[model samples]
Target: MSQQKPPLQNRVDPWGVLHAVQARGTLMGNRGILHDDQNRIVRHWAGKAWLSCVLNPPFEQKRSPFSQGTYSELFFLDEATAFAAGHRPCRSCQRGRYDAFKAGWAAAHAASNPSADAPTWLPIAAIDAVLHAERIGPDRRKRTHPSALAGLPDGTFYAAEGEAWLVWRGQSLRWTFDGYQRADAPPAGDEVAVLTPPSIVTLLRSGFRPSVHPTANLYN
Candidate 1:
């Protein structure tokens, strides 16, 4: 018999669930420590500050071994997928992207503040608090809001007929553990359950373009 591979516990989906999959993605992420010494996932998360990072970040290199940190190392197929999972860019490793994300987030939220002079910059705690409310509800379940499919910006993930789909460049792409596959275009008037949090969706609307798997370009 062929030797079976040990199951890994760090593959994260858009809803923040972890799975054992062979497909390793371009981006790495985490939400505190959820794994035990055996590398088994013991909890959904330990904190609300979920973050997406570059693979094998140098900053992480100085802290501890990859799998020895307080958080279990997680992987995402692309930045878009990571964002949909309620993760923001890691400041230590992805400084440039984090700056852009911070700027975009401030701008997005400021637009709706109904104040004449809203702050253009916000603290990390403030940002995380807003994202935490939108991502996890009091019931510890993924929170979703309704939005018309056509009105959503690119990189906004939504659910329909029990499948996850990414809205990109006027297209809907199905999300798999491996890559994005094309899905049938839904009606312009169809309202769907948006998986990406409202705050992140607003940030996307403010033009914070996420890096998607190259497969997303296949349909174009």
Candidate 2:
């Protein structure tokens, strides 16, 4: 008999790809408890509010990862992938990162607004609402907006030629569960479909650095 794979290994990633790898992720989120009777994540998310989180918490008891539970245990390639999948940093385990992300997000908006009445802070709920709309569409496909590749900061991912590519130091690296591979850079002035949310992109452009896979350095 063939070796059976763990259910979580079969889970689909935010980029609409499936893989089995050992790289640990730093974030977690919920899409309304999407496990089946056999504890497999189904194709569709139950609702909005896809979240980002830290890997583990001291308060929670140890249990089987992705066991039959209220929420499915989804993993990402990195923080950039999590953001691309429309997740923000978790406020509990990743409080400091969350605060920084929130501050960057608010600053991005304030710079764009630049009005005397513009709020200096934005509520998490408000950010989630915007992400919900940007991450998915009425048809449930991953929503993407046209953006210049040069304008995107490092750690962002975009869809091109039906594959996901990462932006890193002026190059586009093809994304994989194991690592990223070298790929063609988008031509100057070309507008490609951006997977990461506009606000998160703004935060990245504003110098909010996100963690990337170690393999990302091989090409650099």
Candidate 3:
């Protein structure tokens, strides 16, 4: 009898790139039920809101990862990937980080808005709504905004030459599951399509540095 091939892994990078890897992730995120009846992830997401969460809760009962569930357990390369994927830190398991993220997000927007009545803090729901629209289009492909590569903050991803490249410490690194490959820097003034949302980009510029993969260090 022919042995059945192993099921495909369901890990996702910040840019919504899927990977079938043996290495485990440190955090978990969700994009609703992207899987079908057979528990296989389809090319499209079933819902709009994506969320970033801790691996496990201290008080709640633990379940196996990727167990049959209402939501798909998407993995990230790091917190940077999670944020870029349009997920905010979980309010329950990651309260401290969540608060910081909220504050930074609010501050970033407030700076850009420059309105006297802008609130100092915005609810998570509002942030999620904006992220939902920015992360994906009506057809579920990754949406991008036009911005200069130099203007985008560290931890942002941009599309160039038909591939996603990560910006880190003033350099562009080609994204790969194994590690990032150093690539030629795009023109500082040229407009490029930014993968990370505008608000999150502001947060990064406002000093909310997300964790990056070790491979990023090689370029620095």
TM-score of 2: 0.86
Give the per-residue lDDT of model 1 (tens digit) for 62-158: 5532365577788998988888889999998999999989988888888867497888888998888888899888899988888987679999999
Q: Which residue ranges in model 2 land beyond 4 Å of their true spot?
A: 1-5, 9-27, 185-189
Q: Indicate which candidate wins on lDDT.
A: 1
Alpha carbon lDDT at 34, candidate 3: 71
lDDT of 3 by residue, 8-123 (tens): 55667657766777554667776676776676777546565677777666754566544665667777767777777677787777899989889888888898889989889877
Q: How many clashes (backbone N, Cα, C below 3 Å) per candidate?
A: 0, 2, 0
lDDT on C-alpha atoms for all candidate structures:
0.84, 0.73, 0.75
Pick by lDDT: 1 or 3, better one: 1
Candidate 3 local Cα displacement, residue 166, angstroms: 1.5
Q: Write the per-residue lDDT of candidate 2 for residues 51-74, one digit (tens) a residue.
A: 666666555557456566566666
Q: Give the per-residue Cα lDDT of candidate 2 at 96.
A: 92
lDDT of 2 at 45: 70
Q: What's the ranking of the predictions by TM-score, best on top?
A: 1, 2, 3
Residue 4, model 1: lDDT of: 86
- Who is ahead in TM-score, 1 or 2? 1
TM-score of each: 0.91, 0.86, 0.85
